[model samples]
Target: MRKSDYRKLGGIVILLVLWWLLAYALNRHFLFPSPFAVGKVMLCQLQNTAFYQAIIMTLSRCVIGFVISYGTALVLALVTGHMKWLRDYLAPLITLLKSVPNISFILLILIWFNREISVMIIVFFVLFPSFYSSFTNGFDAIDQSLREVMILYPQSLWRQIVKVELPLLKPYLAASYESGIGLAFKVGVMAEILGQVPDGIGKKLQWSYLNIEMAEVFAWTIWLIILLVLLEHGLRLLWKKRKE
Candidate 1:
């Protein structure tokens, strides 16, 4: 392994040791579970089919919400990038969406929709503004020279977008997706917990918390961290391949 990898592994080892020490000092299983206890719970959970099902369900919702939000942002950014008046008109709406507390959206959505739909909608609302901003910034960042060259060459609009805009937007798009996916997952889970969705990781987490199953709660959290790390690693691979 590389030196950096070894350093990171060492850091993780130190962190685990510190956590174990803290848990031992506290001597309260309800409040703090040792890494070994959480690992045992995680092993048990891994044997349960429901754990996989809950992960799949939550992931499906998160992906669907992210796709919709991303697609909408891409289309709107393309339009509003050229239309100053439309951009101005939508500014307040974007600002409102960005500024509103996530809990308010969750509460309102819970009232208006079923638990599953509410979770998806909350993910959408929470992520859309940030995605939209990333895309708009990409559009704005296109070089003036490139704009003039495009005008002089007079390519078809679709061709121009494919050949010019998307290439310029690649970095911004990548940045948004990398950051936004994790945020979407977290927001989706939070919504699920608040909405009390019948089946999800959030539901399981809520149940564990209510029952004061600290080990189970820690296990679930460790699972989430593992999932997120895997997701980010996969995305990084995809992005690296795309760049190549």
Candidate 2:
């Protein structure tokens, strides 16, 4: 590693040492577990079959919700982009959805749907507006002169879309995707926690909190952070490849 990388590693070690010292001084497991104890618990949890199941269940819901939101947003953007009148009609409704609190949706969805389904629904609509706005902006940024030329050439819509629209929309699409994934996971997990899904990370988190298992709670929270970081890195790599 480079000197800078080593410096960062040293900084992290220092922070961890401080945290451990603080935990020792506090001497209350309910309040704070030492970093070593947290690490041990985290490792032990990884060996449990339920841990993997929880991860899979949460990931499944998050992935489904993300796909639904992304596709819906794309379709809506296409429709409203091509139809100015429709854009004006739907603008307020989209804005309303965007402005609404995610927790409110979680509670409302729980009332209307099964617990498992509620989390998926919450993630979907919670992320929809962001994707919609990004795509709409991307579509608006399309070059009129190039579009007119394409029209003159009588190119098929698919050709125009693939060659022109996609290139113009690349950045917006990337931004929407990255942002949507993170938001979807967060909101979906929150819904699951509240709705009490039987076998998900969120449910486990709630159980840990209720039982005063502070280490377990921290472990689950750290797991969520790790998932987010990996997903973000994957998206960045994909975007880089696309640019190349």
Best by lDDT: 1
> Compared with the true structure, what per-residue lDDT tens digits does model 1 show for residues 63-162?
8999999999999999999787999999999999999998899899999998888887888999999999999999999999989998888989889888
Error of 1 at 98 (Å): 1.0
Superposition error at 205 for model 1 (Å): 0.6
lDDT of 2 by residue, 1-244 (tens): 9999899899989989999999999999777988888899999998999999999999999999999989898888887876899999989989999899888898999999999888888888898888888899889888789778877887776676777777888888888887788888888788888898889999999999999999998888889889987988898998899889
| Candidate 1 segments whose C-alpha is farther than 4 A from its true place | none
Instruction: Pick out the ten consecutive residues of candidate 2 with the lowest summed lDDT.
Output: 155-164
Q: What is the C-alpha lDDT of each candidate?
A: 0.91, 0.88
Q: Each model's TM-score?
A: 0.97, 0.92
